[model samples]
Target: MRHRLAELRGPGVPAKALDARALAALAANPGCGRRALLDGAGVDKASLAERLGAPAPFGQSQFALTRGNAFEARVKADGGAELLRLAHEALDRGAEPPARARLPDLTATGPEGRAARTALALREATAEAGSWTLLDHPMLALEVAGSPAFLEPDAVVVHPDGRWTVVEIKSFPMLDGAADAAKVGAAARQAAVYVLALERVAAHLAGPPEGPAGAGAPRVRHRVLLVCPKDFSNLPAASAVDVRRQRAVTARQLARLTRVEDIAAALPEGVCFSPELPPEELTAAVEAVPAAYAPECLATCELAFHCRGRSRAAGAVTPLGRPVRAELGGLTTVDDVLAAARGEAGDPDDPVVAALRRAATLREQALREAAEVAACR
Candidate 1:
């Protein structure tokens, strides 16, 4: 499977590692087979989009990156004493104050080694009974579409009761005890991926004899701590975000995704997505895999622009938005929708067709009334 993925990514091309953000986005749009297959193969979608003449417009500025890094550093300073305190206040109020906690060294050679070390640390922390253990930038592994994706959360804290909580640090300001809802939601989704990865580790530690949530197994908390700057100051503020829904949705989507090997087997021979390939060939390679395009994808996917262009060219009503497409009901193209609205086609008994005709009549009446008023004036 790995060899096949490598071939799809092109000979001698290094595959891009999938991060928590990418995994969250993939989970949010599970119906997009193109994204699932490309991501599973570790293909760089940004580069692919660039070659296809629709470069992705989403990226953080260098200044924003620097500020974010500084904020994260401050939050994690002093062996993460401040971070632990915030976690206690936000998620474990009744427990003993985190005046002192253990910060284990998770440094290792590579991702696999780090993941192993993290698993070991979690086990040790769970065994400590009444101690608080903080792991900074712990590496975790989660399988998506039959591929292993390594995720590193900002921090993971093991509570006295053997409960593990994920901590997300961001530079976005939390004013009046609230941050931007969209940013917070994105953070929650990203953290949900971490929580899911932690559960996999916990399950492994529990073994098959004992179920994942067995007595001795580590417990992954569904509520993750979101730490961000407070108001206009650089001070850190914490909020507990419930991610049970996001975790459940992501888990289900991942479970139902088509395996990378299966998608690869169905592709034509000699198809590759290397940016070095000719433009036409690269386009062909991308088009080989069907995409579920929606306007919502513009914010999350690097290949959204390319997919949007194709969707519009094919007259797919999906570009109008998912909700609009749903309301259109079986009207998959703009031409079909217009024909229905004009009463030239479609079954008159159909509720959707009747609604379209009524809407068209109202629109025409409004336009006519405005024109008549203007002419009178």
Candidate 2:
């Protein structure tokens, strides 16, 4: 399967593994077969985007990147004193606060070794549950589209009670009691992936997969701690985010995503995505896979601009947004909608067509009125 995906990427280019952010984005837009196949194959979407003539949007400003690292360093400083204090306030309100924390050493040579080391740390934490344990920069593996994606959460907190909590630290400010809704949502989704990954580790901790995490098992809490900057200050503020919904939704979406094996099997015998190839060949390789493009993809996908251009060129109305496309019913393209509006296609008696006609009439009247006002002026 790896060989097939590599073939899809041509001869010499190294495959790019999907990081946590990319996996979260993939979870958000699982319907795009192009994204699923490309990501599953570990193809470098950014390079593909540039080669296809649509560079992705700007990445983080250097200032933001520097600030983020500084903030994280501060939060994890002094053996994670500040982080533990915040965690105490966030999840262990009823119990006494932990004065000390165990910072486990999970250094290993590779991802598999690191994952095994993390699993050992988690089991150790569960067995010796006298104090708080923090697994910092632990590596976790989750299988997506038949490929293993390694994820690193900010921290994992193990309570004295044998349950584990996923801790997510973000540089984004939480202002006046709340953070930006969009940023918070993205963070929540990302955290949910971490939680799901933690659950897999929990499965190996000895419970029969359905029982409570106790003497024989360790459970991953559904509510994760979200730590962010408080107001405009650098002080970390923590809150519990209930990711039950996000977890369930992401799990369902992930399961529904197209498997990489199937995508590879369906490909033509000699397809490749090598940037070394001619533009025409590269373009043909990309277009061979069907993509469900929409405006929302811009925020989460690097290939959005390229896909949007193709969608627009093909007159696909989905670029207008899903709601608008949904309203158009069987009319899947902008040209189709325009033709229906002009009574050149679609039965007028059809409810969708009638609504489009009415919308067209209102738009025409509004435009003429505006023109009249301009003419008089």
Candidate 3:
């Protein structure tokens, strides 16, 4: 019935349309200025009332992937209407079909998209070598805590030792020291969720135990591997999680899961599962994902312009898309970049930023001189 209902619905409109509506509401209500967009959508208030759950609600991997596909379609189409049409077509087909994946155009440089393309090429190379099954492989739904759940790992491989390993391909290059712990921990948690789900699936398929009767059990052990570049410029590296780490993560996540009810209760009236954070905060937050601003995020993040605006305003590309306007300690404008270039943004606090600033000044000065020369001639 749920399947039929989904089939009956038309393709989904872009989440931006929903965001636009929410933004409009915020515009309309300047007093308390409601931040709950999900409530405005009508799903938040009605569906999840008083549901004190254990643990924070995390998105299933399949749900994340499906929404990602929808966003990709929207960006490729340049609007919401076309996204809706594509979504409806997908729904009518009963299950979403695989579409050709979009690749970023790296040569057209505004920023460092090539770094991402390089990482992708390496992942493809690994896939070619059969180090892992390539992405988009059809995976069967598995049992989760006695309920059926479907998942598709970014990559999966059957090791020669006969263990199933789940691979999450992150485009970020590993940073030095323990500085990247939070980033790594988050990835590990997500991977652990998949591991737990997969374990249940393996157990379900093992069926009834047979003693001397020669019945074999499924040989799936939970292991996870995260593939990331060790350094900039396509250096190969990976982080492997042993069963012990997986168990520790699983325990922590499960404990958090139990409080899902409380989180739901604490949410403002009418809010739904849709997450919300200020555009400013969210931009800063993802930077913690280390190269999370890969083409995927740039294309899909509705707040990309907001983040980019902040980055450009700040004058340094290191923390791209940061809002430094009005705070003016560092370079905050094109003029500030110019000043820095001319030894003017005070000290050489940031040389790369100063260099870009200097270039801009040179270009401006050249333009002015060209105009004066032309006028005189």
Candidate 4:
């Protein structure tokens, strides 16, 4: 299966490994088995999507990546002086500014080695109670759908009082003391993944499970520091965002994502996701894996348009949105919905059917009234 997935990358194009943001977005639409299987197998979804005639703009340009890195560097300049100062001012003004913060080396060969290094750094930072420690680009591992996902947060701060904070530095500006709400929400979701990963690490650490002052017991605070450019300036400003609810929801959803092994076990015989296959073959292979397409997937999933085309062609009710689909009862397709609306099928007494009939009648009356008014005019 690994070999088969490797072949799906088209001989040279590297597989787009799932990142924290991708995983979070996958969780945002948790109803797609197609997405789960492809993502878990590290399939080149964008390639498949292109073959299916819907090329998603998921590729981040190197210039944008470099610009983001530069922005983060400017914010974390001078040994993270501005970041920590903003953190203090935003989170705890009473606490004195951190002097002489420790920056540990988290360099390692791979995600596994980096995660181990990060854990070690956290432990050592926790032990030193008199000073502050900043972990930059710390790789944290999370178990998602029975697989390990490595997440690197912008920075993690271990305060003197035995508390840890997640610092999220974004290139987006905090204009007029506020940032884009949607962007902030996305950042919060990404940070929530980090917080959950840290909690998993904390759960395995030694000591009384809860260290002195409950430090050992998952010291990750729910309120994380979100630093962005202050009103178009290169200087960064920070705001404390409480992601407790998002954390709980994301943690639950991540755990509930269908495991790749199970999805593979259920695949039809002789179906491979090789990118070398013809477009028709690829489409057939993808279609074999069922998907729950929704309107929300347009902004997130690469395969959304492919799935949507299939759904619309099949008249599947899900493409119209979940609420409309829910009101349809067992009618899971557009044809069924139309049949009910036209009084050609379904029990008239059924609430869904009855509501549809009433809606249809109202629409007909409104149209007739408008026509009559036009004729009179």
Candidate 5:
């Protein structure tokens, strides 16, 4: 499978590693087979979009990146004293303070090694009983579409009672004990991915269900700590977000994704998504996989522009948005909907067709009334 994925990514092109944010976005749009296959194969969608003459319009400025890094550094400074304190306050209020918490050395040779080390650390920390353990930038592995994606959360806090909480550090400001809802929601979804990854490790440590319930196993807290700057100041603030719902949704969506091997097998003999391919050839290769395009993808997907252009050219109603597409039923194109509305095509018994015709008649009546008013004037 790895070899096949490498081939799809083209000769000598390094595959881009999938991060938590990308995984979260992908989970949010699980019906997009194109994204699933491209991400599964580790193809660089940004580069692909550039080659296709539809570059993504949005990216963080270098200044914003530097500021974010600086804020994160400050939050994690002093051996994570502030971070741990915030976690304790938000998620583990009744536990002992995080003064002199253990900051284990999590450095390892590679992602696999780091993941193994993190799992070991988690086990050890769980055994300690009443001490707080803080793991900074811990590497975790989650399988998506039959591929292993390594995710590194900002931090993971081990509570006194063997509960683990994922920490997310951001530079976004929190005003009046609140942050932007959309940004916070995105962070929550990203944190939920980390929580899911932690659960995998916890499950492995617990092993199979021995009796009625797994006893004394490390528990992953559904509420994650979100750390950000407070009230237009550089000072840090933290909020505990409940991610149980997000975690469940993401897990379900990830499970529903089509396996990379299956998508690859259905493609033509010599299809590759390499950005180096000729423009026409590359376009053809990408078009081979069906994409569930929606306007919401514009913010999250680098290939959204290209996909949007294709959807518009094909007269696909999906570009109007998911709700509109869903309400259209069997009518997938603008022409089909328009024809049905005009009573030129479609069965009269079909509820959707009848509704369209009724809407069309009402629209015509309104237009006629407006024209009469204008003529009177």
Candidate 6:
């Protein structure tokens, strides 16, 4: 029986460390509103921000606690430079710590403490290949962009022919379709950033003339190799095929990497938004507006309490805040969902409006009966 990716990689303590950092960043800066997320059907920024900001009863980190079980698993599922790059990028962008220790202090005892050492061991292995060379080896610096990114992989594998692969280990089951395009894209962009950073370091060491790779030798090409579990629950019966799928995913991810300069330019001056929602849309969607909620809205919003109260006060049908169902032409929120749910919102001849009006009556009746029962109680 073939072994799954997770079995080989074991637990991803390093990955968990990265997630902790990300959660910390989110708390430090909670971004714009949830309206855009509602519109896009994506992750709720407000909820995430609130969760991050809320003090844990036990003084535990929320991200670490919530994702603790799957830290290793997620690391297994995450592929290549993309995930690693995101970790590095998030760290670089967020906090600025004083140089208490110039280097990562590799020999520190304990599993988590020795991450830097494990990372270096992997790099030395990768540099053995003819095509790859761990530039400026055995020296310390603040950024790994100047060195082979993993920048510290569990191991870096340089092919005899000059290609390089960064290997990350994790212990988690691989699930198909659960991975979103945006998440994958973010991972890919991250790896691409590492490649760009390493290339700069490599170029500097080799000296200029030919290109970023150097004039005399062909540039070192890089790939990310994510090791993860083949099946749920660390079952070894699963195969290594999961890694192949991740590789394909990484390829797709490369297409989404925006140039670092471009991303820098896009960021608003002196502003950091949590949840990473688009600033313009966020400003328009949330800000001093009347709150409202519906069954759908309640399902995903942290601001539901506020919205629900507002909706009830307004007495609007569909319970989606102030906009009466009639105003939306007897439909749900968006035009597409409304068309699908009502099927005749735009039709003039159809009696959709009349039918919705009747439904509203029934809803009111139910509310009145409940209110009477409450009074008796």
**Candidate models: Cα lDDT each:** 0.91, 0.86, 0.38, 0.82, 0.91, 0.36
Backbone clash pairs for candidate 1 read: none
- Per TM-score, the best of the predicted structures is 5
Which residue pairs overlap in candidate 4's backbone? Answer: 8-275
> Per-residue CA lDDT of candidate 3, range 1-377, in tens?
22221221113411221221222222222221112222222223111211212122323488656654543333234322332223324222242232322222223232124323323432343323312122222233432212233444454443222234555555555655221665565566556655654455445533432322124533333445555545653333455554447445454433322122232334344332322434334333323221212122232333334334445555543343323332334554566555666665556555565555667678889999999999999
TM-score of each: 0.94, 0.93, 0.33, 0.94, 0.97, 0.31
Rank ordering of all candidates by TM-score, starting from the highest: 5, 1, 4, 2, 3, 6
The TM-score measured for candidate 5 stands at 0.97
**How does model 4 fare in lDDT?**
0.82
* TM-score, candidate number 1: 0.94
Q: What is the lDDT, from 0 to 100, of the residue 70 in candidate 1?
A: 95
Worst 10 residues of 2 by lDDT: 207-216
List ranges where model 4 is wrong by over 4 Å: 1-15, 59-63, 208-217
Comparing 1 and 4 by lDDT, which wins?
A: 1
Poorest lDDT segment (10 consecutive residues) of candidate 3:
45-54
Residue-level lDDT of model 5, residues 194-261, one tens digit each, is 99999999888854322212465438889899999999999999999999999999999999998878
Give the runs in model 2 whose Cα sits over 4 Å from its true position.
Answer: 208-218, 364-377
Model 2 error, position 24 (Å): 2.0
Model 1 lDDT, full chain set: 0.91
Worst 10 residues of 4 by lDDT: 208-217
Candidate 5 segments whose C-alpha is farther than 4 A from its true place: 207-218
Ranked by lDDT, top first: 5, 1, 2, 4, 3, 6
Clashes of 2: 0
